[model samples]
Target: MPSGGDRHARDLIWGRKSDALRDLNRRRVLRAIMVSPGTQVNLAKFTNLSQATVSGIVQELQRENLVVVDGNDNERGKKVSLSNVRGVAIGVEVSYDTVTVAARRVDGDVDRVVVDWSGRGAEHGSQAWMRECVQLIGEVVRRTGLDETDIVAIGLGIPAAVDPRTSTISQVAWALDWERGMDPGARLQEHFPGVPVIMDNEANFAAYGEYLYGAGRGTETMLFVKSSTSVSAGLIIRGLIYRGRHGLASEIGHLVMDPLGVVCQCGNRGCLETAVGGARLVEQVRGAYVGYRVDLPNSLANIVERAKSGDLLCRRVLQDAGRNIGIALSRTCNLLNPEKVFIGGELGRAVELVIEPAIQTMRLHSLGGMFNYVAPMTVEASELGLKAGAQGALAYALTVHHIRPN
Candidate 1:
């Protein structure tokens, strides 16, 4: 027969082990709801748990105020959603010519505002630009019917590499004029007191946003490239952003293509960006039509519009840029072997003109053995499009809001 102390010790250890398993099951149920709200039946299917087990876990979560049951008490009809999530989240993306702010309840639809700052002195490091961001965020909050006090977190996405250790933008991020150690997140926090702010590279957030809610959904691994005024890439491995040490992992735009070609802002020659960035494409078109054409595109958007309207020069330039971007992406694909590739930003809007050529070029450069070993990778335009960065920021804020300690 066991002694009293031995029995007590056995009971305590078993009880704790049981509690840990239950906690893990509860987290699985909660995550399924966060991905997309569904009835208990649907959650059971999504999580691969028995229906009875899912129901019990859902009930426990509801009692703890972690989930809300929408609709009637009917088990088949009621939908489960996250409840009492504390507060809403805001995502802001700042570009050279635009600022986009999106606000949403932690478990609801998003409301957004896009403000064009082209030629209006909205340059980075300018106080006016920061003020404009604050104003637009206020407008988005109003649209969402949420007060500033209800903002729990704000996510800022910039077109620059952020040092994870120091939280500073890199000097080579020429698109931004922000000084070292200048925290954009901190600046936004001043407007919404008590709310914490998170920041990351714009492409990184865009990739995360797409992974969670757009084309990259259901993919185990994916790479997202943004080819707009500049070129950048982001990697999503198993639904999480893979920011390498120092957050410089996916600086594909700076990858050198030619040692003696055009000089890049990063002090490199013939970087991928120099060959395929929107400005360079525009330059090529402008120079080609210098004396021949009466109508010239003033911007990359204009060129895309012209290409859609059957301008051969515009079409060729976009195709050429696509090919170059594809060649660069091929090397990355060989290394990471992503299941899907998503293209976003301005040029991504012209899928018919750009994506096909990109796919062709990538196939040409990729390893034949790799292609034979796995399923042929799919390439698609980003479903979030220009809103990817802002939406990603919002999703990131909501995801981290509950985990951060006060």
Candidate 2:
């Protein structure tokens, strides 16, 4: 016999699913309008629910002034749609080194912004910084002329392992201690009250962003490599972001290179990041120029500039890092054999210097047969640039899956 606790848990799952379903239907209707502006979604496309249910919900939404009928189909005889009032969703991406805030108008048009936080995760406390992020979101909403009432949800991205089903972030990312067990989705509730929020790892969101609006467009499968202040990877299959059994699939930074290597932030040893992470690379460069009166820039852009200006030392440093990174990617590619590879983030800006060696080394170490199919694996820069994570966060909010607030 089932116990009361089990029954309650089942009820919880059903409730969450129902709520998610309703949220999804709303988004689908809104998405149809956003794409065509004047394009109308046939009322029948919303077959996930009963006709009565869909009609009632659509009526409620119409009553709220959130949606409007653009016009009825005259040729084939169907309903048409256009968002009467723009609904809004907020997206925040908190990386190891920066904070980016953007406001998306779900109804009429889309707009976004990216900001680099001077205070990093490992430096100031996460909670203190989280409050700052909340404040920034408010500013974005105001600047965009979006009313909080129209914001159905907020999506957030962090560079850490997050359990998608349970919304329970992994214990491995101790580097971001402040976010541990904080329930990122719940935190936004404290600020927005009735509004919902969704949070995920930056890499997963980036992969989705690229799939929807960036390099992965029209591709069946894609793998995104994020080379930044810290490093991570995301996998997309059939246009869906794949988070492993424990929501820890893309923890490539912790992929051990040498069993006896240095310790990783995840308590592992000799991770790929230890060899080519931006911070690690910077440290190595600093070590190389001990007495040359040379000082390194705090950001990767400066390094790229110097490398572009004929600085042999800078070029060598980036190339070596790329070589190490490529070695790591080569091993991963052997396992997945994805169709395309897109690189993004800070270090990614120097793909020319780093990518060639990375690919050369990756090819040099890989199996011969894998090379027979695709030519050079189509390595390219991120089309989304800095907004990749934010775009992904908003995508998460709009999707049916994920443990985000809504």
User: Which one wins on lDDT?
Assistant: 1
lDDT of 2 by residue, 1-406 (tens): 1111111111111134455666666545444433223322233332334455555655765686655554446422334343444455666777776777766654433333333343444335567657777777777766656556555566778777787767767743565565555576676668887665777788888888788667787676788888887789889987678898878897677788888998877788899887877777777767777787557555666777888888888899889878888878888888888878888887677768988788788778876666666554566778887778877776566554343444
Itemize residue pairs with steric clashes in candidate 2: 40-81, 196-405, 196-406, 197-405, 198-404
Candidate 1, residue 82: Cα displacement in angstroms equals: 3.5
Query: Candidate 1, which ten residues in sequence have the lowest lDDT sum?
Result: 1-10
lDDT tens digits by residue: candidate 1, 252-311: 898888888999977779999999887788899999999988887888889999999999
* Total clashing pairs for each candidate: 0, 5
lDDT scores for all predictions? 0.74, 0.66
Evaluate model 2: give its lDDT. Answer: 0.66
